[model samples]
Target: MEQQTQDKSTMVVFSGDLDKAMASFIIATGAAAMGKQVTMFFTFWGLNILRKEEYVNVKKTFMDKMFAKMMPQGPEKLGISKMNYGGLGAKMMKYTMKKKNIVTLKELIEMAQDLDVKMVACTMSMDVMGITKEELIDGLDYAGVASYLADADESKINLFI
Candidate 1:
């Protein structure tokens, strides 16, 4: 009989707002970069980031006043480091990223997808949020509770963040 080696880490479930969605991806990206299998289940607003169209429509809260004015609207407006100081924060972020050559959220999402990060959208949330599968990006993993739990149960690092 052949013995199989199990992955050291379990699943990580992320549930929350847009910022939380970005944070979750950062963690998933790190874990995957470290050679650990990562699964990011997006429910509710978190799923917005996964939508191809919404990617360009990602809006910052009132907190991004200046940034909102200078940078593009939606996720495309945010730079790496996920820092938005509220005032010149967006501009400073754009300037810093330009100086340091950092990647954008859109780029991260693309990279994560290419790396097989397992992006799943919540059917329940979709229905409630009035988002249809057609509204989501093509080629993404989409499902309901049974599907999500299938991954959640296999995960040891479950988080509701």
Candidate 2:
């Protein structure tokens, strides 16, 4: 009889919205808790969720500076995907979550890290978006799409958000 193994999950987080990030972490942590190895590939806007909360002083080109200025700095700065009327909707959603005693995105991120979820920042996307390693949070693997594809190939579940 062929041995059957049930484990491994991979996700491509493509959205920078707070709700989507939260969902990704929630799923990732759940899978990790269930004894599955989880990998999260953060590309494009999703990279914002891994950024540092404080400003990172790094020399950059004019375009890079502009991009850095326009993008959100960290998880707390992300807006909701819908009904975000200039960030008001995000605020309301956050307030409601707090009132309901739901876990915060930051807490979920910490939980994911503690659970040993592999988080990879897309190198190509970082270059295109003018993001530097210093601007991102620590303890992340930096790789390109091929790395994500490899993990996805071995995974039983895959998601793009």
Candidate number of the best lDDT: 2
The digit string of per-residue lDDT tens for model 2 on 11-64 reads 999999999999999999999999998999999999999999998899999999
Give per-model TM-scores. Answer: 0.65, 0.97
Model 2 is weakest, by summed lDDT over 10 consecutive residues, at 1-10
The runs of at least 3 residues in candidate 1 whose Cα sits more than 4 Å from the true structure, single-residue gaps closed, are 1-19, 54-74, 77-95
lDDT of each: 0.58, 0.94
TM-score of 2: 0.97
Best by TM-score: 2
Query: How far is each candidate from the true structure, as Cα RMSD in Å?
Result: 7.0, 1.5
